[model samples]
Target: MEEIKMNTIYDNEKFFNKYSQMTRSQKGLAGAGEWHTLQKLLPDFTDKTVLDLGCGYGWHCLYAAEHGAKAVTGVDLSEKMLAVAKEKTAGYPVNYLQADIATLTFPVATFDVVLSSLAIHYVADFKRLILNIKQYLKTDGILVFSVEHPAFTAEGSQDFYYDEKGNILHYPLDNYFNEGIREANFLGEKVTKYHRTLTTYLNTLLKNDFTLLNVVEPTPATELLALPEMKEELRRPMMLIIKAKNNL
Candidate 1:
């Protein structure tokens, strides 16, 4: 399949403005739940060279530096996002770069750990991206990432059928086998995402010689349960986290 160039909705001026106003943890990653679970799967960063693909706002990059990573590089497609990340990571060891994760290149075996958070789904050819990722990691280096769950993305709409009484009847699962670009509403604007099956996600890593370490479909934490909106997450997974080792 031909790769789609990433022009993420995050690059939209209004969306970036709104997104920039939110706290890092609130937007996603850190605090608890799936984000916290993904963090637990990471290897120690002490003195390790780390690279973050699609590193929005450089939260993970900053975290790696704070945890004693010798060097940290953050790559993102959005100039606005990279600017924010650069400003936020000032005085830290993190280096922010503006580049498309799908097409970015790096020296072979340059990093001990590669991380991406809530990204990668925007790329049309994830298998190819995984292959590129393998070339950038050292032997036994780790690749950790999170993306929208196949089950959730399969529908594109990410909506549940509800009765007139406003109760959810059931979650739809049509066109699950049809993989490609999916358009949906996000923060009152239309956004695009790519859908891939669970098999594709796992098999691609295996085909690229990556050893699968762990997979997680996060459940809401105890504190999150108090929020009504978070209740829907209990019914179905919204995200999938995977950790793999470059065994080359």
Candidate 2:
């Protein structure tokens, strides 16, 4: 993936601040499943120093603070995102910093947990990112994150079509296990995302002095299943949750 820019509306602090506020108005971000997912990860957070990478608007950071975390620090490439994060986290036990994830400069061994949710895919230099995250996590510290499923985003494996029964089938428009770099959309435009097989991710985690503990594939919610158009693919993975612990 190349160094592509974020949408200007999302790049500027003023615009991003409003953008985030607007998102909160829409419906839900940490809707039920996410709330429960966080509950499942609670052991990783209690009384811990947490670093939230790509912490868009500080949603998880704020949640961490509310959950008895000693402190939560969030970092993001967009000053705007960070700015809004700062505002959103005000009066809470969380701090927001503006920085690019690919070149983060957190002090070595500084965090008990380095977590990210739905954000790491934006990094172009993912290998370097894997290495850098090690610098901040304490030994036995965990790296827990969620991202778009590689299988769903892979080239030939990604498609939205129908079968003989007229039932919708959303399968590979490309290979499910290819080293492909593609882009996802943000407000009708494109942003780069790397598509790697699960083995690729596992290998990278292993090479970085970390061990995989779990991989959770969240099924679509009841609301999604209730939608006639989404029922066919309800059993499919909508996102992937990965958990690992640093051994170094």
Candidate 3:
């Protein structure tokens, strides 16, 4: 219920080091497990202005620029992440800003498309954030974002219950209706995340004059199932992607 300060945990040396090594961090959008589905939900970027929230490493920013976006802005709170984003973004010419997405503002109708990848759950005030986003977006502009699924966040621990043999027994789901701060351990460090139900996520958008276009819960593709880790994804949905249009 209460908003917390913007989380800059990604700037921590150990966490940043670990995050920098992730497949998505190094190889960009192609390396993300949900990219296949998320990409499908994205509106064509051709000559449109784009704003990417929590744009760690600027993967989506570069993708938009390369795909014909006229202007692209990437915002994040972590300096370490922005450093890497700036370095890797050589010729793409993305405007990367080290600012908290929750507090950052843009002029009305500033962007044609707003994108956030795997970062919304960390926000403490979901409703307020989206309202701000709606104001920044042009009429009928698109908003596409991915977050840790509510089912995955419902358990608080954000991990699976395992059997004695170390096989995942189930991804436990409890306190699903209790939406608030969730202190999760990631990369050997504690990080803050917020939990919100699917109902809240959808209804909030609908109430804010945004029309839902698509809601995708991505899973590994058939070919990816051959990998040992990909099979575990079938047991529970880990990510949620939503695409909506701002209707003035």
Candidate 4:
């Protein structure tokens, strides 16, 4: 197996420092508004074994445990994040493993569900990760994950720019075809991320024999829409959520 390089951005104190302060609900899976959307796509966790890839802070692991999961295993590369996860998930039927999710190994058919939230984008070999996930999940097991939207990542830049009047401006769409590593500022820290087109994400699952279940680009709730700052998300999707099943 080829060794996969781990992205150390999350391990940086600057990023996790800000992340550590946020509550689980405030983080909301990928973002603040997508939690309910993700929840709707989830299968019943009652007594199921679940694995959360790149499980930062153990939020989803704890969530699975809370929802009657028999065992929840969380894998993350960041020791700092794992420490926080351990502290937060103490006493839960959850295990936190500090390992590069891309290179982590598990027994075949070990999990009923594999979950990831905005984590795989940091992985360079997403195809390998998907294939490994297929091996880890039981037949009919589900994989649910969210990532930075291809449209958003395509631009390389963040979002729309406005004039002094705050009127809508053009949203940049550049290099949509170029899919690879991208560097950007996150919470004032320069970070590395891997960008893959929507087709790449879909075709990867299909090529691995995963049956598509659902795809969602969530919209903010009414309360969020009430904020002027949140209106831009309505203009363009920031995240992509996908649910697929292991049919083989």
Q: Quick one: best lDDT, which candidate? A: 3
**Roughly what TM-score does model 3 have, to 2 decimal places?**
0.94
lDDT of 1 at 222: 71
Alpha-carbon deviation at 169 in model 4, angstroms:
2.0
Q: What ranking emerges by lDDT with the best candidate at the front?
A: 3, 1, 4, 2
lDDT for residue 192 in candidate 1, whole number 0-100? 80
In model 1, the clashing pairs are none
Summed over model 4, clashes come to 0
Clashes of each: 0, 13, 0, 0
TM-score of 1: 0.92
Candidate 4 per-residue C-alpha lDDT over 42-144 given as tens digits, one digit per residue, 9 for 90 to 100 = 8899999999998887888988999999999999988888887888789989998888888898999999999998899888899999988988899999999
Off by over 4 Å in 3: 1-6
Q: Assess candidate 4 and give its lDDT.
A: 0.83
Error of 3 at 216 (Å): 0.8
TM-score of each: 0.92, 0.81, 0.94, 0.90
State the displacement of the C-alpha of residue 113, model 4, in Å, after optimal TM-score superposition. Answer: 0.3
**lDDT scores of the candidates, listed in order:** 0.84, 0.70, 0.86, 0.83
Global fold similarity of model 4 (TM-score): 0.90
Model 2 scores what on Cα lDDT?
A: 0.70
